[model samples]
Target: MTGFPGVRPRRLRALPALRDMVAETSVEARRLILPVFVGEGFTEPRPIASMPGVVQHTLDSLKRTAAEAAGAGLAGVMVFGLPETKDATGSQALAEDGVLTTALREVRAEVGDDCLVMSDVCLDEFTDHGHCGVLTESGVVDNDATLELYGEMAVLHAEAGAHVVGPSGMMDGQVGVIRSALDRAGHHDTVILAYAAKYASAFYGPFREAVNSSLQGDRRTYQQDNRNLRDALREIRLDVEEGADIIMVKPALAYLDVIAAARAICDVPIAAYNISGEYAMVEAAAANGWIDRDGAIDETLTSIRRAGADSILTYWALEYARRGATR
Candidate 1:
């Protein structure tokens, strides 16, 4: 055999400490944001059927959970409200005593300024039909009308003491509308995290269940089509132009390319949501003894971080934090 000269890449891989020293990505507890669902009128945390070990927390339980998250040094908690009532226009989304508003106030009061508080500024949770926007006279999502409602919701969230308002409704001009509303309401400091490259994905199935969504049809007409990469960039550009403090790509695992593209173009912090379906798949496989749960979770998060996400929203934040402490 001819002697090969030049390449010796395996040298670094031969040593465990060397591999750790050369690791390009790291997943830390402080870079993860836990998405918590707070439901109305529940005495105990209710397990979401689709997502194992994930729950819809009651207000009292949510307060305790938020305190625990703060103590664990998590970056933040993203709150989702499962309201008792639903309407065509999702009017409860802007009510002062609304489920989400109440949860936000309680969480903020409990955690004080120690942890960042973010609220989902979308109407799907409050809508009867489980769409993210208001219906037109002809019974379709009216984009402009939805932006108006989103603007109102942003201000409400800001007033409820949310440090950040995440607009995930996928409405055109939503970031601009929300930014304007917050500024006018003297909440200029409230950050806007736009779900810029969110696709019309089937991966949201578990999330729909988590929020008790009764979506009658698909949202492909409004959300970005999965096949279109250029469209995602366009959406990201628009949000950035309209003053998005941070931009995000949803269902991070499947859309690493979108996340990378957005990271390449945008100057702001990039976020990725490791959605519920992603969490469920890992948990199910682990439960069946198909994979090591902790290793799988760590690898998944590290992969997302390596794909250029500055922060990640995950259901595994608490578990990961607990595990990290022992390590």
Candidate 2:
């Protein structure tokens, strides 16, 4: 019989309280941001088919849900608008009374200072083509044209009472332009959350449906490639230089490496989105009794926090908050 000389790691793992005491990371309720979809022209909340227990909230529903998010102690709620109409240039995105603007105002008013109201400052949900920006005559996305629109959109969101604006379009110089636009419009306090390393992943399928996206094709041209870690860091660095208050990596579960790597190099707070497909897969498996639903949700969120995300945007935020409150 032989015994190892090293200290036994099993001592810490033997008890739940000991494991909790020595845990490297924790998912606090205040660091989880709930992502909500507000649908225009809808009198009632519509349940999204692919995302179980999630709904496309109407104006009234959105207000109530956002209030719940505040009451549950979430750090913030991210609003995504599902407009009833769309056009080539997504003119509605900049309209004062646009669906998103309206929702943002209402939610901000309801949540007040209890929770941060963040808006998705992108045009995919408002454009007929479902691309993030305007198209050129050759049907390619116009980067410069898109940046102009993004700036306009940021001001609109600020005027609508959004505390933070997230530029998820992946357009070059988007964060800088948005920051400049906000300052010029007297929204100097508005924060910019840059989608720094958003990858063009296949896991966005459920999200497309969530926004009623009309994306005829992929956004691979603009979104970062999944295989390139160095490129992701480069994107993060550029966004930092351009004045990103907080940088983000999309599809958190698949890119924990990118999230951890960003945490190592970047000084700003890091955020990660637990996207729709990630939520749906766990729900599907749990529905069939393949895994414990509650446990899966907690584990996934804990893993993201463990990977060094300062905050997490997830569909499970409200539920997790409620559970934490009860516990």
Q: Which candidate number would show the highest TM-score if scored against the true structure?
A: 2
lDDT tens digits, residues 262-288, model 2?
A: 999999999999999999999999999
Model 1 spans with C-alpha error above 4 angstroms: 1-7
Q: Candidate 1: TM-score? A: 0.97
TM-score of 2: 0.97
Instruction: List, residue by residue over 260-288, the lDDT tens digit for candidate 1.
Output: 88888888999999999899899999999
**Residue 262: error of model 2 in Å?**
0.4
Reference-based TM-score of each model: 0.97, 0.97
Clashing pairs in 2: none
lDDT of 2: 0.94
Top candidate (lDDT): 2
lDDT of 2 at 139: 89
